[model samples]
Target: MRFVSFRSGADEARLGVLEESRIHVLHPGSTLLGLLGDDGERLHEAGAAALRDPYDVLDLDETRLLPAVPAPPTVRDFMTFERHVEGTAKLAGPDGRVPAEWYEFPTFYFTNPYAVIGPHDDVPVPPGCTLFDLELEVAAVIGREGRDVRAEDAAGHIAGFCLLNDWSARDLQLTEMQIRLGPAKGKDTSLSLGGVFVTADELAPHRSGTAYDLEMTATINGEVLGTDKWSSMHFSYEEMVAHASRGTVVRPGDVLGSGTSGGGCLAELWGREGFDAHAPLGPGDVVTIAVEGLDSMTSRIVAYSDRGR
Candidate 1:
């Protein structure tokens, strides 16, 4: 079942289940993660019972949908994709030999929760940004809070998954790298996340690394810019969760981002100069990233020229 956090009229954001083309409000006491954290049998029964008809509950188009978990206590974005790591290494480091620690553990970064925007929202291009890029990724929401969890038991902590676009500012990223403080300015400023939240059950069948063909495509102003397959990742979500919870507790609403795919963005496919010289995206541009089973996230670039003086 699809779960969402939304606000209608003057009401505050709350949890709801998507049914047909409408939304059925989940009781105030019930939470998406809490339900999933319960025992498997109990959780399944509750979810099935909640999936009853939602015709007269609420209009899907009329309400405003917010980020699935607006106030996630912590957001961890992992670079588990080998292609992304090697490509980024070539761009940021020497010899393309990603730090040995990167391979030994799941590397991640924290993002600003306040900067998150929902589906169809406008993404403002930070001032002086000529090279804004989009990274298509899959994010998992932590359900059961745990510390030092074993890799084998990590899957149980996942509540659900959602599509994420970790927007990037290429120039700022380069500038910040010199300090070695982390990707604060390059990443935090331009990130736009959302689309829809799909329950873990819906993604269970695709977990086996079998023939699950999840495809991703990014389009700009109705033009297809890039495409990639999800199966290309070198690491799985369980491995990321295990690494992340090594010495700390992961709580409900925590988000884990699967790094970009092979052709996830132009920066990785082509060098920075090539991207700047060939595929420069400016103001008034709209970017839409879509994953096969997951939903599509669309954002309109608010260029410097477009902003009010």
Candidate 2:
């Protein structure tokens, strides 16, 4: 089943299941965060009954779709793609090489949850940022609470999946990370979600052992960024969930980003194809991404209000 959070006119945020171009609205004022788990499997019934029989149906074009899990409890982005890591190393300079530690476990960084926005919303180009970028990736929304979960059992804790766009200020990120560590302001600018949450059973047919055989693509103003397979990830979503739960707790509404695909971001391309080959994102540039059944997401880059003369 596919679900989304939406709103029309002055009505409050509500849950809805997507069927083609129409949305089957669930209970009024029901947010996605409240229905993120299944019966016994986790908790919350996962809104199965309501999803099976919605309160009303409406044309999707008439209402505004919101982030699948608006205001997630917490968001953690993990580096699970080997090729992306290798490419990032190349961008570091001539002595670049993949770190051995990356092979041992999935590495991740916490990002801001308050900064997340809907798919159709505008992405602001942070003030003073010249190297604006977007990451085409997938994120797993945790369905239930778990601490120190095993990789083999992590799948049960995941409710569903959605596309994630980790918009970035590359120049700021690179400079700061070089001195201190991980990104903060560089990535807190904005984040985009697919807005449609796809249940695990719906995608089970496409499962390929450790990964899903889903084909993902991204485009910048109609130019393709190269299609990649979701199955190529060196670390699976379950593994990332397990690693994230090693010491702390991962609760429902928490999001787990699968990191950027090999060529999902401008940085990866600049690293693999040479820095001069492609340019950074700017105002008016539209970015879009799609992953099989997860529905597509598009965002237009808008200039910061304080910038320019």
Candidate 3:
């Protein structure tokens, strides 16, 4: 079953499972975060029960979506796609190939959890950003708490999966990372999560090794940017989880992102083609990302008069 965290006409946050035309409300005051604890037993029970016997129902058109895991404890986005890494390596690598050390482990960077936005929300263009871009990816929401986890054991800790958009200020990212310190200011601005939260079991049939057979697609203003299969990723979500949990804890509500796919962004296209194929985004540009069997996410780029919003 798919779930969504939404705000009704009254402006209060509510959790519900998506039915055909309406949202079956969970128990009052229950949240996706709270339900994810205890190895997802709460989530499993809550989702199943809500679907089986809903206590309340809301019209789908009367709700505004919020990030499925509204405020993740931490967002660890991994560069799991080799082709994406290879494309980036054209600049970050000595040759055109990735460094040998890259094979040692799954590499990920911490992104801001507070900046996360719901799918279909407006995305503000960071001040002075010229090369605005969107990264098409999927994120696994960690449900259980565990330290020193093994790759094979990572599944039990995964609560569910959600489509994720890692918005990028390419100019800022390019300049900041030159000092070997950041992708911080460039990345901290916004992260878009799909409105629907798909449970792990839903996608289990498509599992292929550490990867899934899901296809990822991204478009800007209704035009296709590119598409790549999840199977193209070099590292699996489980491997990333194990690497992240080496000595620390993978807590409930933490998000792990499968970084940008090959040709996922215009930056890679420019790198591959040696020319600017698409101009940077501006206000009113609609960016959308879709992953097979999961919800499709959309964000409209906007120029804000008030940054506080």
Candidate 4:
């Protein structure tokens, strides 16, 4: 079942489950994390029970959709895609290797949940980002809170999945990494996360392999920029979960991102060749990222102006 957080007219954000294009509103206190904490059977039952006529809840177009999990306890984005890692490394230098530390410990970063925008929202072009890039990723929401979980048993803790666009300011990222301070300013700028919020059971079939057959595509200004498959990742979500649960407690509502996939963005796919010196993204360019069986998110890149704020 698909879940969402949304607001309509003057109402506050509320949780709901999707039932054949209709929405069945959950209780006021019910949240994505709460449902995750429920066992698979219980979750299924709850979703089934909530099924009702779509119009009975609210009109989809009239509602203001928010991030599926608006306030996750913590957000960890992992660099588990091998193609992205290798290609990104090559861009930095010819000698870069998948860092040993990345394998031993899943490399991740804390992102701003407040920066997350819903589908169709205006994704403001940050102050001076001439090289804005898109990273197609899958975000996993934690269902069970745990500490030091074993890698083999990590699958049970996942609550659901959501499509994520790890929007990047390439120029900022390169500058930040140069200081060796990690992806502070480079990554902290903005993070677009939305599309369908599907449950773990829906994606169980593709859980085992380092990669899956899921197709990914990115379009800028109605032009296809990147296309690839999820099977390009070097590591699986289970390993990242296991690594995250080590030493610290992971709570329900925590989000884990599958780093950029190979060919996920122009920067990684075409390197310096993709950039158009004369025509950078202006105020009206639209970007759409879609993954088959998952969902598609479209955002309009608007210039940042003081009056708009």
Cα-based RMSD of the predictions, in order?
3.1, 2.4, 1.8, 2.6
lDDT at position 113, candidate 4 = 74
Q: Which pairs clash in the backbone of model 2? A: 37-46
How far residue 78's Cα lies from its native spot in candidate 2, in Å, is 0.3
lDDT to native, each model: 0.72, 0.84, 0.85, 0.74
lDDT of 3 by residue, 1-309 (tens): 688999987867889999876999998898998887686677878888998899788888888988989989999999887777777666543367777888789889999998898886789988778888899989999989889999999889888899899999988998999899988889978899888888888888999866788888989999998899988888888898999999899999999998998768877776665535678888889988888778788788888554335
Q: Write the number of the candidate with greater TM-score, choosing between 2 and 4.
A: 2
Ranking, TM-score, top scorer first: 3, 2, 4, 1
Per-residue lDDT for 88-199 in model 4, tens only? 7656656666676666666898887766777757776677777777788888888887788887888788778888888887788788888877676556656777846888
Clashing pairs for predicted structure model 1, backbone only:
none
Shift in Å, residue 31, candidate 2: 2.2
| Candidate 2 segments exceeding 4 Å error | 37-48, 306-309
Model 4 poorest ten-residue lDDT run: 270-279
Clashes of 2: 1
Best by TM-score: 3
Candidate 1 — which residues are off by over 4 angstroms?
Answer: 28-49, 53-56, 92-101, 210-212, 304-309
Q: Model 2 over residues 250-278: C-alpha lDDT tens digits?
A: 99889999999878888888887776878
Query: Model 3 has how many clashing residue pairs?
Result: 0
lDDT of 1 by residue, 138-242 (tens): 788887878988878887888777878888887787787789777877777545557468877787677546113688788878977668777776677888888
